[model samples]
Target: MERFWKPLLHFGYQQAMSCLFPVIIFVSLAITKVIDVPHLPDYDLLFIICLATQYVMYRSGMESKDELKVICLFHLIGIALEVYKVHHGSWSYPQDGWTKLFGVPLYSGFMYASVASYLCQAWRRLDVTLVGWPKPVWTVPLGAAIYLNFMTHHYVYDIRWVLTALLFIIFFRTVVTYKVLSVTRRMPLAVSFFLIGWFIWLAENIATYLGAWQYPNQREAWTAVSWGKLSSWFLLVIVSFIIVAQLKHVKERREEVPFRASRDSGQEAKRQA
Candidate 1:
């Protein structure tokens, strides 16, 4: 029973962390729509939700100060992309409020913050570690290029496929080692990116269904978001991974000499298994 319950509890925690933002969106939308606060804007409602979400996180001690800083940075980064994407006609917020920044509602940033929160929570909870982390020379530039391509593709040719190939080259052999219960599990880093991206895409559909943002095609009628966005989310996963990597570096530095040495030795022993 102890062995069975350990993995179950870990899984429950992971799901809770991953669903935190989406659940907030879902419940907030339901409540706001059901109750009438005359003149309370959707954007403002979302802002309150964001604050409440952060407060709950801190009070629960689920996120540390360093993790909060990373989450806030991701919020800003996400907003920058939102501003550009909304301006470029990639997507539109079909609502109005004082919280709007050049057309994007500030609450939009929390969506990205949620991603950071999820990664941070999972890392700590799962005792996650990386093997074969590519050097910054390769990863930093690749992350920058992937982010830049999202904006530049409007004027320049879309190099997403090329970037995707480069991402594979960098991470295909890299493995993510995470523990669940008494056992450790490993998977290729790239595969985790795709799995995460697919889930985010699913969550995006729910967010849109709740009217968080509307793609051009979605403006007239609600439909499933384009499957192509999976690729975009996959690249965004890389960006999220990079940010988490940097944060983890601070934690890793204290443990790397002993930890990595053992982890690497273990990898070698298991190479035949």
Candidate 2:
């Protein structure tokens, strides 16, 4: 029993560490909602807090520069989505802030960044690797289509379900291998996506309650987000995973290239001698 519980405890600890960014974001949201900070709007304050936390994480070596880049990319992607969604009445930021852009707070992007941060952190902490990953030709296009559908669905027909079906086809054989403590574990890539998406949905509930943003129905009172949004989060998670996976693959290949060059040069010198 001790043996069984030990790995579980370690896994939990690693997961908590992996969630540092998101946990901070959520805590910031709750505190700002309840505590009145004089002259500092809640949204703007949250933004400042996020920036400081990110810098500290990088300076302390908790997050690498590359991970920070990924988080920034997600931040921009999120801001664009927020702008569009707010315009279309999908959700609204009900608070006032100087950082508002087109009625959406600039700090809102950090919510999306938090998701990317979690994925990067968990990947590193768990020593995650993918087996049977599909080619980028398949993944890149799929991720693009998924993100496009998020906006295009409002104007044209929503093909999210179709894209999801394609996800099943593309990653059908992929497996995620991860290490926790002294044990190694494997999970189907699709299952991992669903699990992450479900947890994000749970987090969304807490975030919404703390006035992160509100759906049409949530404007007047706090309520659970629709279950339908789970599918949206699931697709978003795939996009995030694909981007990270491709970047990690490219980084590994680049690192390997220099090592291979040195080895080949040494072999040539030996042959010449």
TM-score per candidate, chains pooled: 0.88, 0.98
Which residue ranges in model 2 land beyond 4 Å of their true spot? none
For model 2, the run of ten residues with the poorest summed lDDT: 177-186
How accurate locally, in lDDT, is each candidate?
Answer: 0.86, 0.94
Point to the candidate with the largest lDDT: 2
Most accurate candidate by TM-score: 2
Candidate 1 matches the true fold with a TM-score of: 0.88
TM-score of 2: 0.98
**lDDT per residue, candidate 2, 181-235, as tens digits?**
8568999999999999999999999999999998999877888999999999999
In angstroms, give how far residue 33 of model 1 lies from its true place: 3.9
Least well predicted 10-residue stretch by lDDT in candidate 1: 17-26
Off by over 4 Å in 1: 1-9, 254-273
Q: Model 2 has how many clashing residue pairs?
A: 0
